[model samples]
Each structure stands twice: as structure tokens, then as C-alpha cells.
Target: MEYDVVVLGAGPTGENVADRTRAAGLSTAVVEGELVGGECSYWACMPSKALLRPVIAGSDARRVPGLRQAVGGPLGTEAVLAHRDEMTSHWKDDGQVSWLDGIGARLYRGQGRLHGPRRVVVEGPEGEHHVLTARHAVAVCTGSRAALPDLPGLNGARAWTSREATSAHAAPRRLVVVGGGVVGTEMATAWQGLGSQVTLLVRGQGLLPRMEPFVGEHIAKSLTEAGATVRTGVGVAAVNRPDPGGPVTVVLDGGELIEADELLFATGRAPRTDDIGLDTVGLQPGSWLSVDDSCRVDGHDWLYGVGDVNRRALLTHQGKYQARIAGAAIVARARHCPLLETDRWGAHAATADHDAVPQVVFTDPEAAAVGLSLAQARAAGHRVRAVDKDLAAIAGASLFVDDYRGRARMVVDLDRQIVLGVTFVGPGVSELLHSATIAVAGEVPIDRLWHAVPSYPTISEVWLRLLEGYRDGADGGDGTDDGADGGDGTDGDTDGTDGRGGRGQGG
Candidate 1:
């Protein structure tokens, strides 16, 4: 098959790229090895979030009518499974395929490997192989897969990565999560809420270590209260599972053995670019293809890389942003103009990404934040100012519940009077994050932010308190600091998570 653009993965990013190219009057072909919607749709984000959605909405398999006996609370197992199946279309690949065809993009159902720059070989289902050539460009958007850690006795055991956990019809009774990051926390909370006894083991001292201490503290407390035993600053020294349904006993470094029905390693992910002909395409770092600022691959200007394969921020939204930039950049290059870079807008230019990428941990009393933390700003050579507030003091807190327990903080550049960081933890506080995200992204001056009034008798009103408190000092002055702001978050942006740039993001 010949086309102007051949997108190598039909995930959201690839779909977005192909759509953008088609809209620009380019003939696009999207090749897929498996499900067209890729990992995010079938396994990662969609199914995982769907599995946890009902629990957050106060719906669970143990809570439905006539199915109450199967669970301690009230859910119809059949109905819950029905909902999941409906959400995933029973693992059907048709929705994505139809969406591709609807957009006028030809779809190939086979594994495609790069044969050369702007060239690929497709191993088809019927055992036929075809060489597909693209006239303009080829975008790599293969995404990533669950990473397995090298642990003693962990091999050949009945284990579940995110894929199995998200799609499993029945929950494991005793689940041991091997990582203490966001994925582990969410899965632990979800399964525990659905009646699984969860034990989370972390190599760090706290949960959500990437955020402010206040945020991490609250999440840890919530997770602990939710009945998930969180063991921090510890790791697995050994693990043994004799057979399926047998106990998974994990021995800690200090000689403690923790047993569970199943072990889920939410350690991280490995980009799925292996054996896909990256070596034939010249050089880059790691196993990922190195791309320029405009998402153009190293040697071949027409070839591009997006999503996890580029080794940028490994988040779904970040992947989408890359796709948008690459698509736009391609058009710009065709017009004989310079392509946009990461921080400047033009073709495929997404500059704010390095400075601002926001996400939220959806546990109860959620934790959310954006931008550089205090230490990060300081390390980056910016004068840093950090202020914190507890939810109990603010007027909004008293209104939400008499005893709402949570905290918030904002980091400031003393010289610039612009926000450097923001962190919020409390019920409903997640929605208020955009103001902070905008502040950090826009570098909005403190004076202008003061006019952005938060509604009254709500958590967001704490913004007023924060700005008022900044006074003379919280923005980085001597003693004019104000710290009276606190709330459950009456802010209007949807719920969110963070870093001192790389420091915050690495956690």
C-alpha cells in the first residue's frame, strides 16, 4: 500500500495524527498489529479506569439488587461485568476499526515493522507479507507495555500486570502490589474497595512521592484507612508461588514474608519498540527513537516518533500532544517553513509540555498538582517560595463537613511573582487545579491571579486566602507572607498529580 502518511499505531495519538494529516488533504494509512485503539483503549487507561470508575461512584459488584449475596455490600457481579464488557465492547476491536474507516484512513490488521525510512513490512493475519511505502512520512506511536522487574523466584509464577488486573472478571482475594507509585495506589484502592485485601510495598518512604509532602501524607493516610497495608522503605527480597491459587509469599529484606493471592508489579513500563526495525533507521538513545523538537526522527526528516517510544513523559495525554505537534510540523515542513519546536507554537510545537503536564491520582481525597516544586525551582536557579495550608482552617472546610482533613500549598518565584508550583489534597479539591496549571503555564503574574475570584462558601475561595496571604512575602518576601487560605476546593478545573520538573516527574 502506498500513502502520503503511514501511522504505525492506531491508538489515540496515531488516530489523531492520521486524522490531522487527512484533514490536511494527505492520504493516510494506519497500520495495526492488534486492536486498532491500541493499549490505552483495550488494556491500559480505558479498562483500568473503567474497572475503578464504579467503585469511585459508589457502585461495586457487591451493591446491586439480587447480587448482594455474592459480595459483602451491594453489587451485581453480572451487572458490573456487563458494564465493563459494554465499556470495552467485550474486547472487540471493531469500534476503533470503524472509527479509523470513518475518518477515511485505511487500516491494516497485522504487525508492521520498519523496513527502512518511510518504509514498512506488514505480517498479515492470513500469513501474507506486504511492503507498504509512504510518500511523505511514517509516525511511530506503538506506546508501551508493563515492565517486569528482575526479582528472585518471581519468574514462571502466576502473576498479573495491569493488563490482567484490568480485564479479570473476578478480583484476587489477597492482592500484593509490588510498586508504591500511582498505578499501584489506584489498583490497590480499586481492588480493596471491591473487597480485595491489598498490601502495597514501596521502595520509598511514602506514597505519591512525586508530589508535595502534604499530598503524599494524605494519600498514605487514606490508603491506610482504606485497609491497604502500605509498607514503605522496603522491597521484595524473594517471592514464591507454588501454583495458581497458591499464596504469593514475598520476603522483605529484613526477613519478613508477606503472603497474598496474587502479585501485581506496577513498577513502570517499557516502550514497545523492540524488534521493530529501529536499528535500521539510524541512531537514537536507549531503545527509543530519538526525534527532534518537531517530532521528526533523527536521520529521516519524514519519519516521526510519538508516545512512549520517544522516551518523553510516559503519559497518555503527553502522547496525544506529541501527535498534535508532529502532525502540525509535517504540514509546516510541506509549506516550506520551519517546523515548531517543543516550547514554541508553529507546526507540532508544544513548548509548555516540559514545564506543564498535569495529572491526578483518583483515590479518595485525591492528590493533584502541577509545575516545579520548591526544591526544583531552587535547583533550576529560581528563587523559591513555598506556603502550605490545611483544609481544617478555611471557611470552605467548615461548610463541606465540620471535619474535612487535607492540605494545600503553592510555590512561588519571589522575583517574578508568578506561581512555580501547586499541590492540593482533600475531597473535591481536584477540580480546582486548572487555575494553578494556567498560572504555571501562563506564568500569570500574581496581581492578575488575585482578580480571578474563587466562588464563596467553597474550597476554591481559598485562592483568595492564598493570594491575600502572599502579601508581601509568600511570593518570596521577608515578612509580608499570608498563610490563612484553606479549602475542600471549590475551584472549577477537573481533578488532578507533579514534580520539580524532572525530579517531580521521575517519582
Candidate 2:
């Protein structure tokens, strides 16, 4: 089979690439080894969020005066699991396949690898071989997989990765989660609400070490208050499960043994490029494919790497953003267009991956942030200031839920007077992240942001509070002005790459 574009992996990243190419009249073929919709659909984003929604909803209700008494009961775990199954189409890909068919792109159900430059060989399900040649480009969107630690007995211990953690039939009586990133923290929150006694172990000083320090502190306090033991500065030594269907024993680095019905290793993610024939192209196997700002492979003009494999930003949305840019770049090159919109925030540039990547962790009190954190902005050598607000102090927050507990922060570029970053942690802060994302991405001036007034009484009022604090020079914690400490500001990161650490499972 010969096509204008050949795409490996049919995840959201791959799907979007094919979508853009097909729309531009380019014949595109997509290959997949698993479900068509990929990790975000079946395991990571969709099913995981389905399990967390009810848990968060119930938590939100309990905080309300009249609703508190009504929701004071155990959650219906069966219904939640059933709903999760439905959300993932019971682990089927018929709907996604149909959508792909409608887009006029051909789908190959098999493992695909690069046979040579611009050449792909797919091994079909029945061991049949199909050779596909790409005339324009070959895009790699294979994404990533869970990276388990090198520990004893882990292979036979039946330990859970993000896949098993999201698709489990029922919550275990006791669950021990290692790694305090998004996957571990969110799963701990979900299972704890679903009647599991959860013990979360973090090797770092606290959970979500990539974000602001307070984010981990606040989430740790909330998780502990909700009946889960949140331990920090801990590492797993080994795991043991002697019986086929029995409890697993986790040995800590400090020689402490803890037993749990199931153990989850949400360590990190490894790029899925191991067996994709990288060696055929003179690149090392099991290595991340580096790409330029346009998602094109660094050395090969005709090769592109989109999504998690590029290691730009591991979040699903950021991957899709890169997909759109890659698709546009491919189309432009194919048309012999001399001028590709390669400038920052241009049509063919994925600038958001660097400065405006937004992420929302769907825990009880949702943690959301976009752009730079205070430390990040300062480290990037931006003349910046940080302002904060207590959500409970906002009038809208009190009306939204009695005794509302949350915090908000805004980091501003002092010289430019534009918002550098924003962080919100509260019951429904996830919905408020996009507004902050726009501010950071657009580089909206603080004076102009003040004109974009927030509504009278909503969680969004936190925006107004943030702006007021910035204007009044109120640091929210200390009344002192926290300014830059001798930054050269010469080596600005030109590539649109967010320096945030990658914690995949599609984030």
C-alpha cells in the first residue's frame, strides 16, 4: 500500500494527524496494535476520569449544607465501575474505528515499523505482511507505556500499572500506590473514595513535585483528611506475591513490610519506540525520537514525531496540539509552500507546548495549572512576581460550597505586565484552567486582563482576586515583593518545549 502519509499508532495524536492530513486531500493510512482510540480513550484519560467524577461529585456534595446529609453514605462502586466501562465503550473500539472510516483514512490492525526511510512494513493480526510507502511523510505517534521499577518479584507480583488501575473490576480492600505523580495521586484518591484503604508512597519530598510546592502540600492534607495515609520520601525495595490470587507484600527501602490486596506502580512512562525499527533508520532502539518545533524529526526532513514519543509535554492535549501542527507542516511541505508558519504561535507552530500547556488532575479537590509556576518563571530568567488568594476568602467560593477550601496563585511577568502562569486547587478549578491558559498563551497584559472582569459570584472570581492582588502588590503569603534575583534573561528557550517533567499514561 502506498499513501501520501503513513502514521504509526492510532491514539488521539495519530488520529488527529490523520484527520488533518485527510482534510487536506492527503491519502493517510494509520496503523495500531491495540485499541484505535489509544491510552487516553480506554485506560488513562476517559476511564480514569469516569472513576474520579463520581468520587469528586460525592466529595463536593458532602461540603454543601443541605446536600451533606443526603450524600452521607457509601458510594455505589458497582455503578461507578459500570459507568466507567460504558465511558470506555466496554473496552471496544468500534466507535473509534467508524470515526476513522468517516475521516477517509485507512486503518491497519497490526504492529507497524519503519522498514527504511519513508517506508513502513506492517505485520497484520494474522501474521500477514503489508508494505506501506509514504510519499510525503511518516509520522510516529506510538506514545508511551508505564515504566515499572527494577525490583524483585515485580513481574510475578501481579502489580497494577495505570492500565490495570483504571480497568480493575472492583476496588481492592487495601491498595498501596507507589510514585506520587498524577497517576498515583489521582488513583489513590479514587480508590480511597471507593472504600479502599489507600496508602500512597512518594519517593519525592511530596506529591506532584513538578508543580508549585503548595500544590503537593494542599493535596496531601486533603487526601489525609479523606482517610488515606500519604507518606513522603519513601521508596519501594521489592514486591512479593507468593500465591497466584493473594495479597501482595511491599518492602520499603527502610526495611518496612506492608501488605495490600493490590500494589500499583505508577512510576513513570517509557516511549513506545523500542521495536518500531529505529535501528533500521540508524537510530537506537528503545530511544525517544527527538523532534523540532514543527514536530519533524531532528535530522530527517520526511519523518515526524508527535505526542509523547517526542518528550515535549506528556499531557494528551499537548500531544494533540502537536499533532495539528505536524499535520499542517506536512501539508505545507507537500504543497511546496516556501514559507511555513514557523514563528512562535504561528499556524504551523505549537507554542503552547512550551508556555501555555494546561493540566488538570481530577482528584477530590482538583489541581490545575498552566504556563509557568513561580519557580519556573524565575528560573527561566523572567522578571516576575507571584500573587496568591485563598479561595475561602472569595464570596463566590463560600456560596458555591460551605467552608470551601482552596488556593489560587498568579505569577506575573513584571516587565511585560503579562500573566506568566496560574495555579488553582479547589473543588472545580479544572474548569478555570483554560482562562488562565489563554492569558499565558496570549501574553495578555495585566491592565487588559483587569478589563476582562469576572462574573459576580463564581469560582472564576478568583481571576479578579488574582489581578487585584497583583495590582496591589499583595504576595498573598508575605507582604514583601518577591522579585528576580539577578537573571541574565539572555538564553530564552526558543523551542516551544515546556520544561515540566514528563509523567505519562497520557497524563
Candidate 3:
């Protein structure tokens, strides 16, 4: 069978691309071997967040003075597990399949691989073979899979990857999490909150090595306080599980052995390109595909690589953004229309992938950031300055919790006086990230940002404090200048109190 577009993965990226192409009057067919909605729908994002939301809510309730004693108990494990199952649709894809039907895209339930230029071959579960040809383009949105380290005896140990960690029916009593990246930290947080003794093992000096150093420091402190053992600067040398159903023993580099009911290796991710027949198209298998701003594969105008396979931003939202751009580009090509203005922020350009990618880590004291960190900005040769503020000083934070422990920072590009990046680590700060994303993506000037006032007595007022800090620093003096409010330049009480003397502050 032939169509105007054939998307080789029915994940979020592929679904979005198919939707766009279908909307543009193209005949699109999406192929997948697994559930239609893919990883984010069943395993990674949705199910994980479903499990964590109640844990976070319980923590939030316990933080309030009047609610503390009432909600100090452990999470209801059975209920949480059931809720997670509901969120993942009990691992069913019927709803997603119905949505594809509504979108006018044909669905092929099989493993899809490139056979040749604009050609795909699907090998069905029943051993039937089918060929699909694309008249306009073929998009590879196969995404990625968790990459585990090659330690001795690891594979046979039945180690938990992000898949198992998120989808496990029951939480392990003792969970040993390996790696300090998002998957490791978040799973540790979720399992620990759900009554597991979680020990996080990281070879690096801290968690979240990609973000600002302080962000990791804050999260590590909170995790430790919450009764999770966080071990840094340690690598696993080997693993042994003589009995498949018994506990696994992890041997560390310095000869220390740790036993746990479950061991999860959240090391990293590898592109899912190993068996998609890239060799037939002159591209190496297992290599991340290179794509232009319009998501067209390098040197192949009819080939597009959207999502994690493209090696652009690995986040789901970013993949959808690329899908939109790629769909538009494909439609333009199909119609024989001259491509117009494919520059940054153009209708068919994925400019945000490079400069304005935003991510939120939904651990306790949610960590969110957008754009480049201070070090990244400096390394990129931008004249930048970083401004910091303790989130506890924000009035809304204190009102939200007695001892709200968090911090916020903004990296400013001095040459253009625009925000280069913004990082927020605190309770309920995830909602504040889009503002930073907009500022960075739009290149809003510092002087202009000063006029955009944050509401008084709100957590967002931290924006005002940040801008004030920048102004004070730009004036070349200590941040003690008197202001119209008859106060020092410091926005909040230095002693970490909300000035009401209700409770002592320390997150």
C-alpha cells in the first residue's frame, strides 16, 4: 500500500506528525509494534506522574501546620498502584487506535522498517509481510530506550529499568537505584515516598549533573531529609543474583556490596535505531539521525527524523514541536510550493529545540529550568551574569508551607540584557517555568522585563526580587540600597521567617 506520508513509529511524535499531515489533506499511515500511545503514554511520563502525584500531595499536606498531624501516614500503596494502572489504561491501546481512526490515518500493527527510499516493510506478528510506500516522506520517530551499563552478571540479575520501575505492580521494600539522572532521582523519590527504603547510587559528585550545581544540592538535601540514602561518587562494579527471585547484590567499585529487593539502573538512553533498516538508506544503524531545522533528515529531503531519534531535544513536548514543523515542511513539499522563510521561528523552523528547551523534573520541590545554564552560556561565549534568590523569602512560598526550601536563579546575557536561562527548584515552581521559557525564547530585554511586575505576596514575586537583584548589581554596590518601601534591597527577611513569627523556616 502507498500513502502520502508514512510514520514509522506510533509514539507521540509520530501521532502528531500523522495528525498534521492528515489535516493537510494527505493520506498518512502510522506503524507500530507496541501499544499505539508508546512509552510516554504507558510507561515513562503518564504512569510515573500518576504514581508521584499522590505522594507529592501527601507531602504538601504534611507541610501545612494545621494539616501536618492528620496526613503524616504513608501513602495508600494499593490505591496508588490501581490509579497508575487506570492512567496507563491497563496497558491497552484501543483508545489510541480509535483516535488514529478518527484522524483518518491508517494504522499498521507491526514492526516497521525502511526497505528502501520512501519504502517501508512491516513484518506482522502472524509472520505476514507488507510493503508501504510514501509519496511525500517517511518520518522516523522511533524514540529511544534505556541504556544499561555492561557490568558483569547485570543482565541476568533481572535489574529494573525505568520501564519496570514505573510499571511495577508492587513497590520493593528495599530499592537500590543506580544513576543520578532524572529517571533515577524521580524513581527514588517516588518509591521512597511510597514506603521503600531507597538508596540512590551515583558515580558523579551530585544528582542532576546537567542542571545548575545548586539544584542538585537542594534535591540531595531534601531526599536525605526524607529518609532516602543518597550515595554519590560510587560506581557499580558488578551484580550477582544467583536466584532469579531473590534479592540482587550490587558490588561497588571500592568493594562494598549492597543488597536490595530490586536494583534499577537509570544510566541513560540510547537511540532506538538499531533495527529500523537505516542501512538500506545509507545511514548507519544505532546512530542518531541528523535533521535540519525543518526536521528533514540530512541529505534526504523526503526523510524526516522527529523526536529523540533526531538527537534534538529528547523531551516529548520538543518532539511534538518538531513534528509540527516537519509536517508543515512535508506538506509544502507535497504541494510543490516554494519553501518560504525557513529561518528561526519561521512557520517550518524548530528554533526552540536549540535555544529555548524547557524541562520540569517532578521530584519533591519540583526542579524546572529553561535555556542554558550559567556555565553553558559562558562556554557558548556569551557575556552573562547569574542572579540568585532564596525561594523561602518569597511570601507565597512561606504561605504555601511553613518551611519552603527552594531557590531560583536567572542567567542574564549582558550583551543583549536578555535572560539566557532560568532555573527554579522549589515546591510548586513547575508552573513558573513557562514564563521563563517565553522570556528566553522571545529574547525579552532586561529593562523591559522590569516593567512586567509580578503580583505582590505571590511566589512569582521572586521575579521581582531577581530583577531587583540584577538592578542592584548593575549599580555596582552591595545589594543593601534603600528602596521606596523603606527597606533594604533584600526582598525578604534574611532570617528565613515570613515576618509573622508563625514558624521557624528551613526546608
TM-score of each prediction: 0.87, 0.94, 0.93
Candidate 2 lDDT: 0.84
Query: Which lDDT tens digits does candidate 3 get at residues 83-149?
Result: 8888777888777787889889999989999998999999988989989999999999998888888
The residue-by-residue lDDT of candidate 1 on 331-389, one tens digit each, is 66766776434455434565545677666677666677787655556667776666766
Winner of 2 and 3 under TM-score: 2
Question: Global CA lDDT of candidate 3, please?
Answer: 0.84
lDDT of 3 at 494: 7
